[model samples]
Target: MALLIEWKSGGNRFMERCNGALEAEILACVEGIALALHWTMLPFEVETDWLTLTQMLQSREKDLSASAHLVREIRRLIDGDREISARKIHHAQNQYY
Candidate 1:
């Protein structure tokens, strides 16, 4: 479902596992950030292997995809709250992290 790992010096960190829609995982990230990173507005960077989700988030478009609703939820959480960004990277790049 969802998991969170925090480092003494890193503030709050998390890793989530999802076997269903990829958008759910993205939603988890949004929720996690909102709850854990609660404070003055700050920029948060998220890396993902799902290029489609990333594109949707970056473009602020919600349509066609099953995860579109979740994407919209993420956008809502990010709206006027935090600068949350999603970047696409190869799966291999995140394998060891």
Candidate 2:
């Protein structure tokens, strides 16, 4: 839950410093989605322990928070893409933690 993002695909890895947990979570998802898009990896699910973040991304309404742009970008990437989805999981179930 402490701003951690880890991925393993063909020996590739990505990590970045973030100011807070929320930013880290958003950035992680953005990076993951972008990577999936770049690699043409469809039918993937993004799992997160933050229920609010998950709901925000799934909502159709606008987000007026400071991270609205990133949220919108996430929606755009996921919109019309039935192959992509977000799921809320328990913190204990998160593998990256």
Candidate 3:
């Protein structure tokens, strides 16, 4: 199924079209990380319901699949930045605030 990737923080929000749920999740993460870095917000935590995505981000090895580039981009963005991390949350806990 198609997915809508969105990131909302304070008064700022971003939306983007994605082909799938995983891609959407990844893109949303990318947007969030970029924004956090832009705002100079250190010690940022990215909460996600997708366990695979969380694991992928925490992995030490490289991803060589179709979405490898996007995953790599995420790594590039957070590399050497210990202030950023991705955490897995229960699907029910991911509701709108």
Q: Candidate 1's residue-wise lDDT over 1-97, tens digit each?
A: 2232331122333446444757555765666657646753456666677887678888944466766666777777777744556789797865532
RMSD of 1: 7.6
Model 1 worst lDDT window (10 residues) = 1-10
TM-score of each: 0.60, 0.73, 0.76
lDDT measured at residue 36 in model 2 versus the true structure, 0 to 100: 73
Q: How many backbone clashes does candidate 3 have?
A: 0
lDDT of 3 by residue, 1-97 (tens): 2122345543334556556879877887888788777876456777899999999989989787677899999989998835677789899877764
- Candidate order by decreasing lDDT: 3, 2, 1
lDDT of 2 by residue, 1-97 (tens): 1233345333334655556788778887888888876765446777889998898878878788878888988888877745777889898877631
* TM-score, cand. 2: 0.73
Scored by lDDT, the top model is: 3
TM-score, candidate number 1: 0.60
Give the number of the best model, judged by TM-score.
3
- Cα lDDT listed for each candidate: 0.62, 0.74, 0.77
Weakest 10 consecutive residues of candidate 2 by summed lDDT: 1-10
Better of 1 and 2 by lDDT: 2
